[model samples]
Target: MAYRLLALDIDDTLLKSNHRLTKETKEAVEYVKNKGVYITLATGRSFISARKVAKSLKLSDPYLITHNGSFLASHVKEPVFERRIGAETVYQVVDILENYHCHFKLFHEKYVIANKTRQKAQLISRVNLQLTDPLFYPVHYVESPSHRLIDQPLSVLNIRAEFWNKRERRDALEELEESVTGIRITPGGKEELFINHESASKALALQNLASRLGIAPYEIVAVGADMRDRDMVSQAGLGVAMGDAPEEVKASADWITRSNDQSGVAYMVKEVFRKQLRIETPHQ
Candidate 1:
């Protein structure tokens, strides 16, 4: 069966290591888009970060699943669906992170609030120079407890404790998992953790899109890099893992493609829309 929709993961899957779309990828997406296949992005980033990539590709305002599926938008600045952590749960998680001295960033719809000094914020900015447009807004510095202005609906609660050892980080996560209810906790990176509402997973968001488009869950193609991508990858008819993805993530995929820098998105488009893959392959 042909895939009616293509759901792509943004970071480390569609975009190169430099966080930019390659020319080959761009041309391939354009080619397939011309053939009338639906293309959308499912990412761990916020709408702000995801839109930049969408704009670069010149997609016809593709559906956006952002904040690891906590928010879905039809186009930039137009929200279609949103899920948020409970206020009580948010306070509980924040308290736990504070006790463990874990650094974190609270993600609302409009901005990201972090409790760190200007110098530390600048350091983080330097590390993530690709996000030069101020992805994070630092507030007054704090040690044990950190609080910031929460203006809009809270979607994702991101905790970055890379400074701590693996054992310590895991221990803190375990504690949080035990304490928090109605929240989904996933490994964001080697040292970071993401806490969101239980319903705010890529699988749910994909299902929502499928329902809206009158498509089945198995009629879509999903791809990603990190373990956070496991749910959607397993649910898609065609699940692709980036070359640099973890062993678990790779195992969950129907196919493994080259790294993002090698234009893997372009490769998939050609294989699917161009009908280059054999009948036994996932795209078929």
Candidate 2:
């Protein structure tokens, strides 16, 4: 089947370990996009955080599946679809997290509100640079985010927390799961966890976007490198997993491309999409 849409995860799937988009990857994306295949980013990142990558890809007006599907929007202020964590649930989560030593941030479309401790601790400094890019995604650091939220009451898409210790991360996950309702906690690893609405997932968001575009499920290609991407990859007509992806994620994929460092996205696009397109085009 000819795939019409390509959904890509941002972190490990698209960007290399250094968090930079290679020239080859960009060109491959351009090649496929020029073939009338729609390309969109399906990332756990907020809209603002994902903007730099979108800008690099020259996606002038592309649909963004952000916050792990909690939000689907073309522009920052104009949202086609969105699901915000209820105010009460947000406060409850903040209160619970405050008891721990982990650093957390509340995700929003325009900006991120994070605990000041993250800045002080200099956690994930490289990633912080991306998250705090003033032109794209500005970060607001506060001493007590829960109190600040009570006063300001902003719409939160999701919450992401980073832990320095593996045990602490596990404990935090357990505590949050036992105490929270109407929230889903996705343990990214021993260092971090993502909290969003239970209904939110990249697969669901992709489905919603595809339906709106009149693209059938079998006409979609999804690529990712993390377990969180499992559902999205499996549901796509042509599911691709990064070579370095977890075994389970690879098992769910229809194909496995090279690792990110080897420019897997470029390989997949050129080898699969471009080559296939060429095969289908008759010599005239």
Candidate 3:
């Protein structure tokens, strides 16, 4: 079946290893976009960070799903849909976080807040650097994260426990989840956790977009790489996993696209994804 909407996860799925859009990928996106395919970016990054890539691709009205689907940004100012972290859950998790040797952060509508002294802010800044030109996304340093969590609605809760081994950290995060309620936990890279409200999911966001467009999930395609991308990738009509994606993620997908370094987004669109749109007509 032909795809009416294309949901693409950034980072490892759309951007190359160096974190820039390749010419081939750009061309591919532009080509499909011109053909009236609705393309949008679904990512774990903030909307501020995701917008740079959207701008590069020249998508003016794309639904930029950011912060792991907690927020859906169609414009620069606000999100069409937002699922904030529960106050009690946030407090519970933050209270639990104090016991670990981790650097954590909270995402608000416009800025990111993290403890001033920790490596979380610096590390995230570095991540943004790789994704775009420097100064693309700025972070806010705060002395009291507790106050902010209590005072404002949060879009995401990120924890980075570099002190523990990757496996250890993942296990620890899983264990921590048992103590908290109404939260969704997913792996971020090797040693980080993306904790959000249970309702904040890429699948939900994709479903909302599909419903609004009067399209079914089977008519939508999603491509992604990381664990956080799993929900939407596996749940989409045609789930595509990048070649560089982990085996677990790759296994969950219906098809495997080329790696990002090889312009996988472009290749998939030009080859695998687009081919499904053609229908043979009966001739007399």
- Sort every candidate by TM-score, greatest first: 2, 3, 1
**Residue-level lDDT tens digits of model 2 in 48-97:** 77766888998777889999889998888988888889888888888888
lDDT digits (tens) for residues 1-284 of candidate 3: 67778889988878887777888888888777765678889987777778878888888867778888888867757577878776676667766765565666666656566655554555655544533333545466677677766786454533333323565565568667778877787776747777878788888888887776677788778999888778788898889999999888898899898999887888788775565553322110
* Candidate closer to the true structure by lDDT (higher is better), 1 or 2: 2
Question: In model 2, what lDDT does residue 35 have?
Answer: 75
lDDT scores of the candidates, listed in order? 0.71, 0.84, 0.73
Measured with C-alpha atoms, the lDDT of residue 48 in candidate 3 is: 75
Q: Give the number of the best model, judged by TM-score.
A: 2
Better of 1 and 3 by lDDT: 3
Which scores higher on TM-score, 1 or 2? 2
Q: Candidate 3, which segments miss by more than 4 Å at Cα?
A: 118-125, 128-137, 147-164, 167-171, 273-284
Which should have the higher TM-score, number 2 or number 3? 2
Model 3, position 35, has a per-residue lDDT of: 58
Each model's RMSD to truth, in Å? 4.6, 3.4, 4.7
Give the clash count for model 1: 0
